[model samples]
Target: MRLADKVILVTGSCTGIGKAIARRCVQEGARVVLHGLETEWGEAVREELGADKSVLVIADLQDEATPALLVRTALDTFGRLDAVVNNAAWVASSNIHTTTPAFFRQMLEVNTLSAFFLIQEALPHLKERRGAVLNIGSVNAWCGEPDLLAYSVSKGALMTLTRNLGDALFREEGVRVNQINPGWVLTEKEIQRKQEHGMPVNWYELLPPEYAPSRRILDPAEIAAAAIYWLADESGPVSGQVVELEQYPVIGRNPPKK
Candidate 1:
């Protein structure tokens, strides 16, 4: 019960890493506001955690007004807010040449802009509680693969936002902000995406050794554990930090080619 009595708003909590984080928070004695596009999953989670411990909110982050509404709903339901985990994102493949203005804008709006507005709308409540904000970033922020150009750029901007807000909020309002850039994680969505991209049926078992040096990819629960640490006071007074969760060094080391 590390987060006993805390009230947390976790965006994209319907699935994947976000779901894991929301579950972990509830397990640690926190009341969670779960937001995402999947109404079914959200309702299931809400029931699983019980009505008193969780609230389900369905909102499209791409909408400009949704951020404020999400904050309002959480406050109305729980009467207070303690932490926020911005984890919803749209990950699509697009190189420089292939990325159109519309595509780029869509990516930024969903991946980065929504988080910015969410933090803005939740600022007052967060300040009142000296709360924390945790942005779920991607390892792609550091010059991602060519196929992920726009997505990478969006994540890079999110990283900057995390740093800038982490510093500013900590100094001005005692609100802590931090981020986690996760490497490849095997989620339901990721597996479906791989299949859509024409990967073999046994793709996980067939992954190149270089990419899967440990014979496995990260699990959503692993990322959740890290998020819990940052959102909880157990992390102390840390802020403006970006922890990259990956199997290999993200900087300078080149994996051996097959």
Candidate 2:
């Protein structure tokens, strides 16, 4: 039980990578506060994790008041806050020409600014516990495809926030901050997205070597496994580091295109 007795607040916990992480946290003996927009999905996870081990908060991070509400939920439900996983994001396809100011602001509000404020509101509690913050970034942060300008930029900002706060928080408050940039993971939404793009049934099974080095995309559980180390006491003073969780090196690499 690496995270035994810890209370973690995981945003976007109703689905995708956040759901996997929340389940893993419970498995590792941590009590978690799960937040999401959908009440049914949040209820499902709350039921799965049981009332004793988890609490569900149905909220939209777009609200200016949401960051504080999440923090309050953690403190009220769990009695303490030990860690936070910022995993919620707004992933959409929009190129430079298509991205309007309002759309860009919406993306930033959901993907970047909310995370910053959540950490800010949680700072006092995190400082008390010498806690940790884990930001879930995307490999697209570096340079995205033409159709992902706004989403990529938002993630890029999140990456920067992780690093900036990782250093400042570790030194000043003894709270560690770090991030994981995951490659393509086969989440429920992703599969549905592929189908929307006209991919046939079971489209991911035969991925080309260039994208999936081993002919398979990443799994959400894999990302969750990596998250445990950072949130656990085992990582030990490591801060301001961003790890790429892709199958291959993200920088200066040429895939076989097989």
The TM-scores, one per candidate, come to 0.97, 0.98
**Tens-digit lDDT track of model 1 for 69-171:** 8888888998999999999999999997999999999999999999999999999999999999999999999899999999999999999999999999999
- Estimate the TM-score for candidate 2: 0.98
**Candidate closest to the true structure, highest lDDT:** 2
The Cα local distance difference test for each model comes to 0.93, 0.94
lDDT of 1: 0.93
lDDT of 2 by residue, 50-121 (tens): 999999988899888898899898888889999999999988889979999999999999999999999999
Clashes of each: 0, 0
